[model samples]
Target: MTIHSRAKVHRMFELVEPIATVTFSDVPNEAFLAIGMRNYWDGYFAGRAAPLGMVPAEVVHAVFYNFADGEVARHIPWVWGKTTPAEAIAVRERGSALALRQLIGELADSAELAQVADLATRAGLSAPTEGRVLYAGLQALDVPEEPVAKLWHAATPLREHRGDGHNAALVANGIGGTEAHVLMALAAGMPAEKFGRIHHLPKAQLDGVVDGLRRRGLVDAAGGFTDTGRATKSRIESLTDELAAPPYDVLTPDELDQLIAGLEPIAAAVEAADH
Candidate 1:
């Protein structure tokens, strides 16, 4: 069995997802809260924009077309106008750290998170520091947030950074946006036709992507990944892990071990709260 077995990849994803989710998906009750939602979004965009050198809003607008459609991206000022990139970045570094600290504090005071503090500390140390460019960038802007939130916040940038890297890798390797979408669909086991429909991409274009992938021996006529395709996916995942590992350099081995041991219960508690 390969080390980056599907299960291993999924488990790793599960461990890191909670922290990332609360920062975005777990918005306040209203869709648009004056303070909480905007601040959270500001931090989110800030973290996202860091690698791009705080380019102007128009640059973000131009590039985001690859990720989101015009109507959707155009609706918000963060994506287009009202807030300047500099301000967004500042808010991201300051507000997110503060928010993370407050969230961790709330959880620690009301829940059993204190029991896992040492473990969380250890776990942070355990994360490897090499090849994690995105993680390292976020770490350079490190704040005094509480341990768990700090870890959580730390995890988000690495994840997003890897995603950014993945997009670059795809383009560099001659895969266009449409083809990249198809490859991801194959990796995730979604039907190509359905994926095309859901994403509002044309069937002909998607079929073209699949055909190109087949010619390259990356997929089969049935649109499933060939052995070569699986290998490629694994390589991409490995590359992503390498890119995400740099921030954990600050943690010592013992701290990493304790964090590994401690995170499960805390994660479970977070899940329980969500339900």
Candidate 2:
């Protein structure tokens, strides 16, 4: 894909992602709790990893790429013992659908949603499976017949497909999981405390990562991106976008435009409700 097309593809998926991922917010906790899971991390890891079956923590840690290993190990395997992968998948889909219905209101049942679901499913299934472990797992699942659930199911693999590519880009550039988070934090101007809390990285470890970045001229004294840091961040994102572009090739230009336009308001609704 050309740079322009790659960027467009990235933006399109960005819009589609919230349709499925809004369940990450507290709104969908009841769905997970109903399945006898402990807490958010239990559902988060279990639900996302369900398609891969009862994989161990090491596999989840490797595929997930950026989460702390201990955090992953705290859940996986243990989560599987609590609930089967099929149950986890069901609750995740249920939670996502409930969240979307609540947030989007009538839009959840609209023909536009159905159309976008179809488009996204086509795009997602068209993606190459080579080296995309997470996406491949999602691809093996059956698409749901319910409009909202179908949309979430379809958007998932597309999201994971890009995520797999993003992880590949990070690995190719010699960035470790915590290091990737550090670079992202600096690039986005996210506070160090927030990044540390989210990623479960200790202050000392975060400092070490930052100091390493500084040595490579990727971070400045003020904990912001240096010029080299900004360039490197841009390159990583560009490569991720490029790798993520192939799936969208299934859509005609007009179909792509329709998918993005249809999803924009739905994504906006999710954002509004999430806050």
Candidate 3:
């Protein structure tokens, strides 16, 4: 199937997010408690154009303030004050190489995923454009300079940039975070109860968001989006694509197509892994 640049980018995210975020699920509790904090912090803090020294509270204010007021309490479950920001940075700086190295080994061992990587290599995406975009985001990071992850590093940075750009689109369109999440849930055909967990809103707060959406004619009483809501979500996605298009400008249409083709099987493989 033919895919647009935006769709290709979204597929790339499907391939990468699982890899980048598996630290939360795959690593042992002790290992995660020990080193995962750095991974989480760097992944979020990096590629942001905002100023440095943004504590978790400040991060909530800047990015998620549009959601419920007490979201920070519900959202961030990690122990605060357990690790200093400096120490977390230090850990990410020192440990990223090892973590990335191990991840590379893991990917290498997977013949299924290896085929995907090989396809990406054959698609003229092996080095320059992907690396360039990856490093561009790394340059924006508040962390001290360090060597790039060197393999599949592009995925994390690109995902981060996409997330930032998506947020910008939502803000520009006057969509609150809760409403945005609800819109997406409707698009995905998710049930209502899942909204509370997925969007970090209380059930009552989520109902409030739904009620507001209903009043706006975006959602019906049953929680599905109306036609206008679907159109609005499409526009939001289009705007996000426009904002995210800059880093990908260097890539030709053919290359983006190749990327989409190359990543589809890998994304499918990832999804089927637990089945």
lDDT of each: 0.52, 0.83, 0.52
Worst 10 residues of 1 by lDDT: 26-35
Highest-lDDT candidate: 2
Model 1 lDDT per residue over 1-275, tens place: 22233443344456656655555433321222333334444445544555455455555544432443342233344542444444444544444344444444455553444444434333333444344444445545543346545555555654554555565565546666556666678777897666642356556755776888899999998879999888877776666554444334444555444544555554555566666
lDDT of 3 by residue, 52-128 (tens): 33346545445533455654443243433344444543444434434443444445445544444443323322222
Q: Tell me the number of clashing residue pairs for each predicted model.
A: 8, 0, 0
TM-score of each: 0.63, 0.94, 0.66
lDDT of model 2, residue 194: 75
Candidate 2 lDDT, 204-269, residue by residue in tens = 877787889888888889888889888888999989888888888888888888888988988998
Candidate 1 deviant stretches above 4 angstroms: 1-13, 26-47, 50-80, 85-107, 110-137, 142-149, 164-178, 193-198, 271-275
Cand. 3 Cα-lDDT: 0.52
The alpha-carbon deviation from the true structure for residue 243 of candidate 3, after best TM-score superposition, in angstroms, is 2.1
- Sort the candidates on lDDT, descending order: 2, 3, 1
Q: How does candidate 1 fare on TM-score? A: 0.63
